[model samples]
Target: MTFDSLGNLYGTTYEGGGEKSEGGGTVYKLSPGSSGWTETVVDHFLPTGQYGVAPLGEVSFDPHGNLYSTTSLGALGVGTVLEISVNGQSRIFSFDRVDGAVPAAGVLVDARTKTLYGTTTGNIYNHGNVFRIAASGQETVLYDFCQQPNCTDGSAPFSGLISDEAGNLYGTTEFGGANGLGVVFEVTP
Candidate 1:
């Protein structure tokens, strides 16, 4: 979960929305009220559709107060990055397993540029990758994991990314380092 500037807490559920027995999940907000905290369902993921479902990441806000997140499954049975604004929700990008797939984390928005960065747990090679989506919606794979011999560079990044003031990205992988026990890595843009 993450807190917005107004102190409202936002998060996503893997299941529990719509009418299906295995619901498609929901994005919700908790606002501190005079009496206590009030919960509101911001967006409900439908069990069936092309829009995507099962959000496994937290929500991020851009400079314009638009919210962003990733779904672990649905859009063509892969996943998608979504943007929610006052105008409503839109899928900004979808994973086709060529660029990347199965994003288990949310995106980090560059407040100045409105660009988005995140990691995927799987790709065509099942090694995962770190990607950058430009403000214009063009996606670029900044780094593909397991590029080195014996995958010493790491693989299967199951988390999101963090950036320093200099714009270096830091994240972790679930497996494939020197010891085959995953690794902490850094990428320069």
Candidate 2:
């Protein structure tokens, strides 16, 4: 979960909100009230649709207060990057399997550039990748993991990303390094 400037905490659930059979998941907000804390369902992911389901990470907010995250399923059965704003929720990008698939984490928003970055756990190469979504919604694979021999560069990034002031991205993989035990990596993006 992440705290907005207003101190409201935001996050997502991997399941719930939709029909019991569907269990598409939901985004929610927690606000600290005078007496106690209040919880509100921000967005309910559809049980069946072209949109995504099973959100697996915390929600991120851009400078404009627009929320962003990824789903582990839907949109051709791969996954999607989504946005929630005053205009309502929308899928900003979908994984096609070739470029990447299964984003197991949320996105990192560059408040200044309005760009989003995240990692996928699988791709055509089955090694995962780091991607960039431009403010205009164009998706680019910034770095494909396991590019080096023996995948010493790491593979299967199953977490979100963090950036330094210099704009370098850092995250971890679930497996595939020198010892086949996963790795923490950095990307220039």
Candidate 3:
């Protein structure tokens, strides 16, 4: 769960919805009311939609207050990057092996530019990649794992990224350092 600038709490559940509703999951909002905190289901990911299901990360907001996140699984057999707003929910990007697949991390929105950065756990490399998707639907692969012949650089980034003032990104890989252990890496986009 994460809080917006307004102090409202937002999150997704891997389960729960109305009777007869497909069990993809639900997006919830908790508002601070005079009595206490009240919860509301803002949206539901039904198992039947062309869209995705099985969200597994914290929600993050862009500068304009739209929320962004990823689901671990979806109907297409690949996960997705989803955006939510008062207007409703939308799928910003769908994962496919050519570009990338299986996002293990949620999105990190550049508050100033609205570009999104995240990691995918599979690719032709079978190691993973770091990618950037713009609000305009363009996806850029910033780094492909196992770039080094033996993947000495790193592999399978299973977490989100941190941005520096100079426009650099830092993240961790689940495996592949000089010693075949996990590693922390920095990339400039």
Candidate 4:
């Protein structure tokens, strides 16, 4: 989960809500209450087909208070980037093999540029990749894992990224490296 400036925690579930459950998942908020912390569902997800299933990471936010995230497997049977506001959800990009698929982690937004960055574990090479999506919804791949012989660079990043003041991205991989133990990496745009 990720915290907003106001101290509210935002996150997603892979499945289940309550006895009122529709069996997909939910976007929720946790805030400090008089007694303790309180959790409330902002919305629920559909099981499949265009709506996205199995949310995999913390919900990200823009400066305007809108929430953003991804479904590990989306309606098209790939994955999708989602932009959620009080108004509801908007599909930012549907993951297809051609564009990258099954984003396994959360997105990092550059407030200065309003751009979105994330990683996908599914691709032609089945490694992983770092991608940038602009404010207008344009996408560009910054790096694909396992590009070198024996995958000396790395593969399958399972965490979100952190960016520096210079706008470089940093993260880690679950596997692949000279010793096959994983790697910490950086990408400069």
Query: Could you give candidate 1's per-residue lDDT for residues 28-139 as a string of tens digits?
Result: 9999999999999898888676769999998999988899989989987889999988887798999999899999999999999999999999999999999999989999
Candidate 1, superposed: residue stretches over 4 Å from native: 20-22
- Candidate 2: stretches off by over 4 Å: none
Q: List the residue pairs that clash in candidate 4.
A: 50-75
In angstroms, how far off is 40's CA in candidate 2? 0.5
Candidates' TM-scores? 0.96, 0.95, 0.88, 0.94
lDDT of each: 0.92, 0.91, 0.83, 0.85
Clashes of each: 0, 0, 0, 1
- The prediction achieving the highest lDDT against the true structure is 1
Please give, for residues 1-189, the per-residue lDDT of candidate 3 as tens digits: 889877899888876664665678777889998999999888878776766887776788887788887876785567888888888878888887777888877888998888999988887767888899987978899999998867888998888888899989999999998888878999899
Q: lDDT (0-100) at residue 72 of candidate 2?
A: 90
Displacement of the residue 21 alpha carbon in candidate 2, Å: 2.7
Q: Return the lDDT, model 4, position 93.
A: 84
Among all windows of 10 consecutive residues in model 2, the one with the lowest summed lDDT is: 14-23
Off by over 4 Å in 4: 18-22
Task: Write model 2 residue lDDT over 1-189, tens digit each, in one string.
Answer: 999998999999989886666669999999999998899999888868667899998899998899998999998788999999878888899999887999999999999998999999999999899999998999999999999999999999999999998999999998888899999999997
Q: Model 3: which ten-residue window has the lowest total lDDT? A: 14-23
Candidate 1: give the clashing pairs.
Answer: none
Model 3 global lDDT (CA atoms, 0 to 1): 0.83
Candidate 3: Cα lDDT at 22: 63
